[model samples]
Target: MADGQDLMERIGRLRPAVRAAGQPLHRPLLLLWAIAQAVHGRPRQQPWSVVKHELAPLLTQFDGAQRGERDVVYPFWALQRDGLWEVADSAELPLTSGGRRPTFAILEQVNPLAGLPEADYNRLIDDSTVAADALSTLLVRFFGANSGSVVEALRLREFVRGPIGASLLPLVGEQYADRKKIAEAYGGNGVMGITPLADGILAVYSDDKGPYPDHHIPETGWIAYTGDGLSGDQTLTVGNKSMQEYQKQEKALRYWHKPYNGSWTFETWAVVIQCRRRWGRGEDKKQRREYVWVLAPVPSPLRETWPSDVVEALAQDDKSVHDDSVDVIPAEVVAGQESRKLSAQERYQQLSDAARRTDGNRTNRSKPTLVERYMRSAAAREAVIIRSEGRCENPACGGHPLERTDSGQPLLEVDHVNGLARTGQDTPEFMIALCPNCHALKTRGAGRGELQKSLVPVARKLHRAMQRGERRKARPDGT
Candidate 1:
């Protein structure tokens, strides 16, 4: 029997060789070698429990040995656990069958050869490695072909090179196959299956292969074909010939058509709506109603079926309830913006004078003075106050106020509880922000009765909340 020292030496030598045999053989070979020795010359095939039971005791004895921990050793032990090998089954032994008892001699037969022919086996391994790498590269390139133009180019090259090139190219002809497999595996739109044309090109013919609908091709641009290849007596122009043709051919075709007075032209339609809002006296003395004038475009098909009321409204100068009109205006003239009857400067001057008088003739009542000098500065401060309040304070209005407008700045005037002109307190608490329509109604003495009753209680609650927050800050630990 080999001594324990001799067995240890043998195992140490085998470890390096097993590891050098590549990733696949590393653990399996180590476990196989260990199991072979433990079962050497045994007639009874031991169960995994028996093998593990035998090996477990040695772990403590070999604890401080040169080898590592249980993780390194458990893999070898697991081989028996998993049924890769068996303890010597006496019934299968030739000697037990009346010939000769199978001894340690069979161990050599079962174990991998210590001196495996390196060249022959290594060549097979190397070829497999190269094939795997090639397949990966081919798959990457095939997936990268996202466009029809790219697919067509690949097809052309494959056709020119013929069978030999196709075999060499990673996924030359199997573009659709790779795409479909990848899509299915990853759960996306399946590969686009395009038909190969005679000119060594591929064209998308249908949407059957994809998960989604195919691109729409207008009837005018769609071409029909009768043959398997591009060449045929019956052919339809699926694409604009000029757009598809080579640059050289494109210029040549243009020159040929020039003498025939054939030219490409473009046209567009304009749909305009003219709306005007007018208020007039009603039959009831105290009631006034607003009238709306609407002019809308009518499509060519609906021209004959146009509503008579709409047409008559547009024809008359008076305001109408509804109107629709269709008139042909030259495309070039319609393309430009319509001319304004009044200039901006004239409107600005008129608005400035009106605003000055509305501001109660405040000192320095110029246009820019009223706006940039006072109103803009006040609007900025009001925006800050609105943000601070978090919402509209008016009890009648519960909506959050997210915006403040310069146009509504006149209505957002700082209103003092005792009147700004009288109290002179410009503090945020003294002033309340209100929307333009709401502010107008308040000034006209419409909603003040409700607002005055609500504001007092809201101010008292807010003041108490501030006092409670101050008290909490003053005393870090409650006494």
Candidate 2:
């Protein structure tokens, strides 16, 4: 157990390992969640099953600095380093070949309990003044005035003196003076369509009357912005690639909108969850493939209301990017190296084999500092949709929603059964195809847990049937 004063100091200075990743609230949020549980006189340690379900939503709700994917495993595991927390049977937990912290899946496999150190838990329980001071420190130092309903939500209202004050982040619906002011404060290009700011922050500018009109989804808390590149085909490069980087890093994109002849207003913080290619006329009046990106607004001081489905979408999309030790070959990496035409099934097999191997963790004496990033497989997505037989896999939604995308593809979302973070597998066995309505219910609706458990077996059985050469049920077109 750590000394009480030292523990409090560590909590105050809580920060992300990579400082340039921006001031992430993962660790702080996890700590607060633990504290809240302790305040309620719950056990000092709790199972990962409970933590993942409860703590993850809290992280998503509060840590709005990042738009996609909250690092639930990192804060839960890394907190032990700060000496304020501990994990039961931690010594028995499996690690990667590099001996680093294992992925969320491995942790779930272990199911080891974790929480505040026994001494710390007792201290908080024994002394109300100490607990109040600690809660105050977290709310003020980390959350600031944006602690919207957090105190009440966490049942820490008795400790808080009066209502938490103003938010530090730019407020939504507030008019900013001009572009120059926003750039000065956030440190991004004032003129470019996409500016990569310091600390992995992304700033995107949209104009109501520009060549690309960014449209809002009525009452949906979402925005549809065309990808950067006003002339010719918009290849994934420059500003467009920067948007992908923000999505890859799970950071929010600060959006600023300029109405025709109106002062530039700070819009909302959003995550690039879905992107599709479509034919459109650029500024040059030539038809070409333009990328349309769907931005999901997360809960932040800038925004007040959030659609339940949008919230579910954010949580689901965020899990697509996991920092597990598993090795996944990106499409770019494979495309750069391979010359042969591999079928989608072959590609799926190859990628799954690569993910199952631990060579990525082996020591590279020559290039010891090489970094590996995981990318989802296109083949896996295609395979699941085809296997779904044009129906929702939920078994309750009846069939796929009677909606077709602009490209004529069935409007179905391919979701992982156990989450990519838990399994680190993008293969069909670990995934399922669902209509938008079913997908939302699986993520945030009541009885989501039962729904999740039911889908795991459904996905596995479907994959087995596919492997046995079952004939795929065709769509109504019969093509």
Best by lDDT: 2
How high is each candidate's TM-score?
0.17, 0.35
Write out the backbone clash pairs for model 2.
none
Candidate 1, residues 1-479, lDDT tens digits: the string is: 22322322222222111122211222333333233332232322433333334434333222222332332333332233332333344345333224433333343344212211223223223343322222222221221222123223223222222211122221312223333443332222333222211111122223233222222122111111111112221111232211122111111000000111322111110011122221222222121222211112222111233344324323442221211111111112223434753232332223323333334444543322222223222322332233223334344543323344442222243343434444333333444555544455455656676665565555444334432332212222211
RMSD of each: 33.5, 21.0
* Winning candidate number (TM-score): 2
- For candidate 2, write residues 196-296 as lDDT tens digits: 43223456778877889577743344676788998887877888876765555444566778888887776776767655454456786555556666677
Model 2 spans > 4 angstroms off: 1-166, 196-200, 218-221, 245-251, 299-306, 315-479
Each model's total of backbone clashes? 5, 0
Q: Model 2 — TM-score against the truth?
A: 0.35
Q: After superposition, how far is residue 467 of candidate 1 from its true place, in Å?
A: 7.9
